[model samples]
Structures are given as structure tokens and as C-alpha cells.
Target: MSRTNIDIDDELVTMAMRLYNLRTKREAVNYALRQLVGDPMTLEEALAMKGVGWEGDLDAIKGGGPIEDLDDIDLDLLPQDLGDLDARDDR
Candidate 1:
């Protein structure tokens, strides 16, 4: 790791530490840097999902039904085990 002396706002660092749940200033700074330069998916990739695994009815949902409508939904229809989607290589 390369070390360099630089000035940074103490309040901002403290906020970052709390927000990111990081312990040290170094960890906070590194986490911030990684977030700043992280590889985000393109719009095309996001649009490609096309509600592949969604069990809900998109048309009925589009009507913006009352919150009480949620009660009618079968709890069993929902995913039982949502294994780490973040760690999926297909993404």
C-alpha cells in the first residue's frame, strides 16, 4: 500500500466512518475511494432483467392498488431462500 499525506475534513471522515460502519480513518477513506471508483452496471444491463423471477403481477401492480391489497398475496409465493444475489457471477 502507498501512503501519502493529505488534508481531509474531519467531520466528513467521521460521518463516513459512521455511515459505512468503518472503524478507522484509513478504512473509511479506503471504503470511500472504492465507492467512488466502483464499477456500476450500465442502464442496458438493468433493463435486461425484464422481471425474470418476479412472481407478482406487473399489470395489477401498475394500477397502484391500496396497501391492504398486499394482504391477499400468498406468503408462500414469495421466495423462501434468497441466496446472495450480490455474489452471483451472472451479473
Candidate 2:
């Protein structure tokens, strides 16, 4: 195999090493390339997934369990404020 050298920022390299538990740049790049092969638009069997991605259910609840009937229930018990967020710091 042919050998090649690529340059990258030291900060990014350090971050990648900590995030991926990799001690080398070659290992990080190999893992990144492998993850790009997964297709996000492919059709899959419903039973094949135990906890895969899913949209809003038609006849079910949002956070699991049975359906919540909204016939005569009060809906004013939810929080509507972003309270204590001072500001977003742009590092």
C-alpha cells in the first residue's frame, strides 16, 4: 500500500482522540468513513427494529404507554418559559 500524509489542526485532533478513544489519526478517519456508508433513506421492516427511529404515532402516546384521551382533560399544567438561560456563549 502507498503511504500519504495529511495535515489537521492540533485542537481538532485532540478532540477526536478523546471522543473516539483513538490514539491515532488513521483510526479516527477510518471510523468516520465507515459511518458515512449508512443509508438514512432506506426502507426497513417494522419488526426488524427494537428501538429504531420513528415518527409521531397515529394511535399511540408520544413518550410510550397507551393513548391519552384529550376529551375532557385540562392542558394548562405544562411549562411555557425558558426561565434561567442567561445567554449563549460563542467560544
Candidate 3:
């Protein structure tokens, strides 16, 4: 809880706040620091995460099955040439 003043980008801070759903700049900064330093979860916390279940299709999420070789990959299924993303209307 040491208070320090330093020059920081407001836009970056705002983007961090939105991305992490943090209420304050302090929270966003702290979260970013934690992520940068690699925050390790405790054993209890890791065990607790086991209770969280996934109800989605596992195979579909895994792209059919285990990719053992590069030759097995379907070239047609992959994105061909996504040129000039700025010209896209979806954004």
C-alpha cells in the first residue's frame, strides 16, 4: 500500500480497466503488475477451480482431435488471406 506518483498513459489505464473489469486505475495497475510478475495460485485455490465445470463440446473446442502431425491439418479450413483488416466493416 505505498502511494507513488508516476507518469502513465490515461488511455492505456482506461483500456486495462475495461479489459479487466476493474473499477479504479489502482486496481488495473495492480492487476497488470500481478500479470507481469506471474501471479501463482495457491494449492487451495487450484483445488477450488476443480469444482468449476465446463458444459461445452470438448471435441469441437479441441478442433476435432489431437493433432499429432502437421500433415493432418486441413488447409482449406484455415483462414486464407485476411488482407487489410482496417477495410473490414464488421469492426
Candidate 4:
């Protein structure tokens, strides 16, 4: 992985560490980046989900979203669920 070093404000770093219970700055940064990698979004796309209930959306809670436009996540394919998957092809 390419390491791009950048300066972050101390206050911001402190807050991220506290919010995530992170022991090192690298851990906090990595956690946040990993959460963000699956769904890269402009700020505008996230605000659209402000009013939705959180009964079933972990991705939205972690990354914020409009939900409707998230095409990468397949909720129907949860591990315990077979849904329409072929019973013969053991996944």
C-alpha cells in the first residue's frame, strides 16, 4: 500500500481516538479508512439519509448514505440466508 502522510488537526485526532477507543493514531485512521473504502461518497450523498431509522443499516450508520443508491452491498445475501441461491452450489 502507498503510504501518503498528511497532517491532521490534533483536536480531530483526539476526537477520532475517543470515538473509536483507538490506542494509536494509526489504528484510528485505519479503522476510519477501512470503513470508508467500501463506499466512497461526496458529502451530499450522505445527508440524504438523515431521517431514516437505523433498525437494519450498519453501513449507513458507519458511512452515512441515501441508502437507495448503495449498489455494492447485497443485503439479501446475508450468510445465514439462502434466498434464491442455488442449493446445489455450496457456497
**Among all candidates shown, the one with the greatest TM-score:** 3
- The residue pairs found clashing in candidate 3 are none
Candidate 4: stretches off by over 4 Å: 39-91
Best by lDDT: 3
The TM-score values for the models, in the order shown, are 0.42, 0.36, 0.45, 0.38
- Error of model 4, residue 32, in angstroms: 1.0
Predicted candidate 4 versus true structure: per-residue lDDT over 1-91, tens digit per residue: 6777888767867888886567888877876786668747546536754676345556644455555655655655444543656844843
lDDT of 2 by residue, 6-73 (tens): 78667766777677567798776665555578635323323444465444443333335443776533
lDDT of 1 by residue, 1-91 (tens): 9998989889979988886567999998887776669857457635755577667665564455555776676566556688767767743
Ranking by TM-score: 3, 1, 4, 2
Whole-model lDDT values for every prediction: 0.72, 0.55, 0.74, 0.65
RMSD of 2: 10.6
Q: Between prediction 1 and prediction 2, which has the larger lDDT?
A: 1
In lDDT terms, how accurate is model 3?
0.74
Q: Candidates 2 and 3: which is better by TM-score?
A: 3
What candidate 2 gets wrong by more than 4 Å, as runs, is: 39-91
Q: What is the lDDT of residue 81 in candidate 2?
A: 60
